[model samples]
Target chain A: MSQSLDTRSSPGATPGEGPDATRQASPAWRRLARLALRQREVSIFLAGVLLVLYFQFSNSAFLSTDNLANLVQFSATTAIIAAGEVFVLVSGELDLSVGMVYALTPFVMFFAAGAGLPVGLAVIVGLLAAGAVGLVNGVVTTVLGLPAFVTTLGTLFLVNGLTLTISGGFPVQPTASGTFTSLFGASPLAELGWAVLLALVLQFVLNKTRWGLHTIGTGGNPVGAAEVGIKVRLIKTGNFVLCAALGGFAGVLDAFRIGSIDPLAGGNDIMFAAMAAAVIGGTLLTGGSGTVIGALLGAAVLGILKDGFTLLGVSAYTFDMILGAAILVTMAINVRLSIWRDQGEG
Target chain B: MADASTGRELLRAEHIAKNYGQVTALTDINLRIDRGEVLGLLGDNGAGKSTLMKIFTGFVKPSSGQLHFDGKPVELSSVSHARSLGIEAVYQDLALINELNVYRNMFLQREPVKGRFLGILDDKKMRAAAIEQLDRMGVRIPSVDVPVAKLSGGQRQGIAVARSVYQKARLLLLDEPTAAMGAKESALILDVIQRLKDEGEMGIIIIAHNYAQIFDVCDRVNLVEGGRIVFDKKTSETSVEELTDMVVREYREARRSVQAG
Candidate 1:
């Protein structure tokens, strides 16, 4: 009975029969290019490459294996946090507390270490502490129906203050140099490889799993998602927790890698950079869609740009100006691509 | 003849009333649909039609109501619970994620899972099934992989309807399915509704202002006014002219009262 219409109509008529015929007839190459442009990450990746090449030409040391390794190590923390930002952004939430979480977790680990806990156990506690902050952020924003930006922003300062109080406003220098630090805070290449691995797994989850699908749906249309039986609030809360947990994890990894924990190391600056990386990578702050791998490329762009400027004797102030310009140019291109897609097919 | 469809109650709502703080959204609403029934709910703006549908779909809690589904009294605690009982509603927005591709939007939170205790979405199965299911419903989209935002209104509506049917919804609520649709698109929805009605496993309640359109697909039509059902009649007992006359009469009376006030 359900198959009645299938037999009645021609078995295989495509959906293109109705909407704009000119678009249906557009050249395959043009369509392909438009598709590529629609993906903002591709352009961002190309921009990153161009920036790298420009630096390599400007200074021979820019592309050296050691310098490249340094770039990876420097970008890994921001990239790790960006992965979580991708989750939160795709689920239609802002996580402004990520930087403070990053700064605070290492101190949590340090205090736990001082209390005679194993490094592994301390790391776990630190991550849990970060996740707890995320839980508070999620509950306050979701359950209480508070605005996400305001809620997370308040939590950011609170976490930063807590970090200062816990570490007494001082950097907790590493007390032990052992396999624990070597394993987690390995050489730049190894840490970068691990970050990439985590990113790819998260990307798979975001693009493939039901949780990822629900997250996208929730962000795309909260009412529509709810109408379709999706747990929209739950998805948002989960993303919030995940974003904070990843931030905490990044702090732990960096502390172990650098052989010290600085309570004042990362502030709102790290959060802003991570958010910028996600945005540059094509993750819309407006939510619904983003790229995980794009975040890595984005972090690399910022990391390389900062390092290249220092190598080129450019002032620290100039770095912000260049980054701000890159964002405007990328966003302008993204808007143009969107306009093209709408005019082309819609 | 026992009139099996009319006798077998699929869903029943009694004395359903809803209050949003100081405002009353619905009051003294009694409604029901039986097996293989197509019930058309007619209402003006703010007549609480959508609110009632929301209550049915478990998106809102009624202050007081008793709902019987498939002869069992049940409280719909959540949208998922409603879905589990084979009740689904497609709103005027179509409840579609425009950014997502047709297949992904169709599956949404209910993707087909395969490996490791359903840990992974079986894309191959989902894509194949999306194509087959859409094909079965006679909805022609160029590709199942295309984003829904790119599809025509008719195609998007078809995808929404096809999704509900594919997911095994036994009681379907369609809020103004043909509101913004073109002639051909409206006909497509009517055909889908008629086909579903004929299948006898599903009962559909459609909210539409068009009396003629409702007459074309519905087995019965209920007119609501002031948050209550004012009149109800089977399609067999009501003609297009009679419905038009009654509605026009009601409109004129409403205008007179407003002018007097």
Candidate 2:
């Protein structure tokens, strides 16, 4: 860094001299390489492409439309949950109870169905139940001044236990009509489109809405945000609620697809995937930066990895190793961009 | 406009004092800023200018004081409440979120909304307004799209001033705006201060140690010594040398008294 500064301050360049006279009159290819390095999202996208190509090369069945659609369906729930988690992550907080909420919401809807309520009403109640859990998480973390990790971790086990006690550790099939099934996860359209649509809307909200802008500001500088009259606590708590609601929505959708709501359907594995997807999408674990489309692409990368491994007859344990390596390499690029950003360069 | 000649009061702080447990931070701080005037508050490291400013800005409640704004005595509930009453503070840190873009930081909490439900931000309007404010401040930058982290120290200060200005604040409290900048950077900020001073409607209180800068942008100056106002004079009436001489003499007398005691 010191050497670069010294070079930048060197006295070789002069006024009225053309661009060629500058010290940075290196090859165009070198400049192009720097540009590629700076565009972290493009690099991540290309990596995803290469992964897809590798899978295609490995098995001809990998690129089949039927198989691709199946892969999207498999990745849909994780991707959806990840899209919401991006909000919480960008706000510099974590929501560990999302997986537990995921399990609880569907059971809530199932209980509603058993009570002879309409399926639509049951789903709304389930989503609201998830939102309530999110509210508790938010209040405990922000209002009570507890750390988000500790608060959500406590709720994670508490919610899971509540779900187990309520459901008596049993799986109950949910009644669903054609419209409801097609809208959530059972039909062909819902399976692939829900994740993509949610990702698009969430990305729009994060980038183009006042709520999104405030969320970023609140996460980026809580003190500054408060100084500017932003209700930082409200934004953070709202983000937690939104994230949990999305998680519940994913679980409900999955329940409709599977035709049964299990007490132990979404566990630690689901939470881990959702968080990994958010990170893979380039949402900073350190907060103050995030991307919704990045989360979708990250889900795609993971989906491809899993489907490819399954087809190649690779064990699930090796799957974690390769996935971890891929995430490390992509995240290295993200860290580089962040470091340059901190150096006050555009 | 209020008559500056007759000493019209835009804000008046009467007998403000702050005590933190056993430590008396500030006592006997009586100050007032007239409309369309710049009041330079000169103080050393612990002379309590900041404490007074914080009290005035509602960040810290005075132990005993009465603040009358526009002739109304009101207790400010919080910093936001003070801001609602048109009191804004620009800290040396600028209090900008470095992770957000220039336009985003400019509109941090006060975003323009257009959508019916949930009020989506009118980003187009915000971007144009940010550009206009920066242009008015003479803050040249590549674009308002980059995060504030990409800006220089001087540019950040200009943006901070611009943010307060755009908020239409009545009394701006600037804490060391030109503290850590190069000659050219400081001159640029000085230009901005001069611009604001020329607005002739808002009151500004600048806390700084730079004597030359105090004379350059301020119409009136106050010397704060030992948590109290030692001298107050208009710029046209007092020279920088007089203020510096008084400060030197006061320091010597204090040292002698301490040694004798």
Candidate 3:
């Protein structure tokens, strides 16, 4: 890194002009390249495209309409949940119970409907229950001054146990009307449509709303936020509620699409996948930066990888191994790129 | 307008004193700033200017004192309470969230809303207002879109000052506004302060180490030493050299006392 800096700082075509002037004097293509590298989502999008091209070349059936539809549906599930996770992550907190909430929400809806509540009202009750778990997560984390990781980790196990007990350790079919199911996930395009719509709205909120702005401020500098009267605790707690609610919503859609609600569904696997998607999409783990659309693209990338690997006859175990390696490689690249960007800016 | 000439008090502190356990931070401080007046507080480090300012901004409470704002005796509970009563401060740290953009920082807690049900932020309006204010203050920057962390220190300070000015509070407390600035940046801020003084609407209390800057922008200057106001004089009556000599004498006396001890 020192050697690279030495070379970068060495006299170029314009001597003693300072970094800003030299940056401006650089060739247009070099400037464009720098801009592209600076926007992490753009690079991630390009990587996704490259991956698609590689898969399509390896197997002609990779781009088949039926396969593409399946890819969209699968990616949409991760994307919706990940979008919500971005809010919590950007607000400098974590919600490990999201996956458990996903598993538990469907059962809550099933039981509520079984108790003779209207199916629509049951779904609302389920989302509200998920939100309640988040509220607990928030209250415990903030009011009790516990780290979000510990609070949510405790909730994760408790929620999982609750799901198991309530479902009597059995899978149950949902009692939703055909119209409701179709609107949510039963139709081929429904989940993807919902994902796209949610992503757009969430992106707008993150960029152009007071809540989004405050969340960023809270994560960026909690002391500063509080000093400026940004309601740091309320912003963080609200994000927790939103994150769990979105996770529950995504679970309901997935359950309807799959035709059953299982206690085992959307355990650690989906949670990890969604988190990976968020990271790959350029939301910083350390907080204060996020992108919802990037998450959608990341989910798409993961979906493509899964579909392509299966088509190429890779085993599930091998897929997991490959996914782990991919995450490490991507993270390493992200760190390196950030270092370069910082150097350039500094 | 008549208060401008009569020095009608905007905020008054009578016999204010503060102590941190056994250590006294302020002692029998009597300070007042009138409408349309700029009061410069000059002191070495730990001389209680900041503590007094914090008391005025409600970040700290005086152990024994009465604060009167606009002739109303009130107890200030918190920083927010002070702000709600139209007292705003630009502290030395500036309290800016580095990840947010300039416009967002400018409109941090008081963002303009335009949509239904927890209305969305009006970014375009904020952006335009921030730019216009910065331009008016002669604080130049490339754009309001980039994160504040990317800006230079002087630029960040400029944004902080501009934010307070745009808030248009009744009283503004600026702590070492030009402390970290260069000649050019300091000039820009001094110019803004001069403009505010010319407007003659808000009361400003500035803390500064630079005697020249205080004389350049302040109507009256107060010298703080050993947790007390040692000297108070109108700018026309006191020279920068006199203030510098007074501070130097205090430093010499303190050194002699330490050696004797």
TM-score of each model, in listed order: 0.89, 0.90, 0.90
lDDT of 1: 0.84
User: Which run of 10 residues does model 1 chain A get worst, by summed lDDT?
Assistant: A7-16
Measured against the native two-chain assembly using Cα atoms, what DockQ does each of the candidate structures obtain, in the order listed? Answer: 0.58, 0.66, 0.72
Candidate 3 residues B139-203, lDDT tens each? 78889998898887778888988898888788999889888678877777777788777888889
Worst 10 residues of 3 chain A by lDDT: A7-16
lDDT-sorted candidate list, best first: 3, 1, 2
Best by lDDT: 3
The regions of model 1 sitting more than 4 angstroms off are A1-32, B1-9, B12-32, B58-81, B116-118
Give the clash total for candidate 3: 0
| DockQ metric, candidate 1 | 0.58
- Put down candidate 2 lDDT per residue, A75-151, tens digits, no spaces: 88998888888999888899999999999999999888789999999999999999999999999999999999999
* Clashes (candidate 2): 2
> Which candidate do you rate higher for lDDT, 1 or 2?
1
**Chain B, candidate 1: TM?**
0.92
Report residue B57 deviation for candidate 2 (angstroms): 1.9
Give the residue spans of candidate 3 off by over 4 A.
A1-29, A35-39, B1-7, B20-23, B209-215, B252-261
Model 1, A154-259: lDDT tens digits are: 9998999999998888787755556666668666766887789989999999988888888899888888887777888888999999999999988888887887
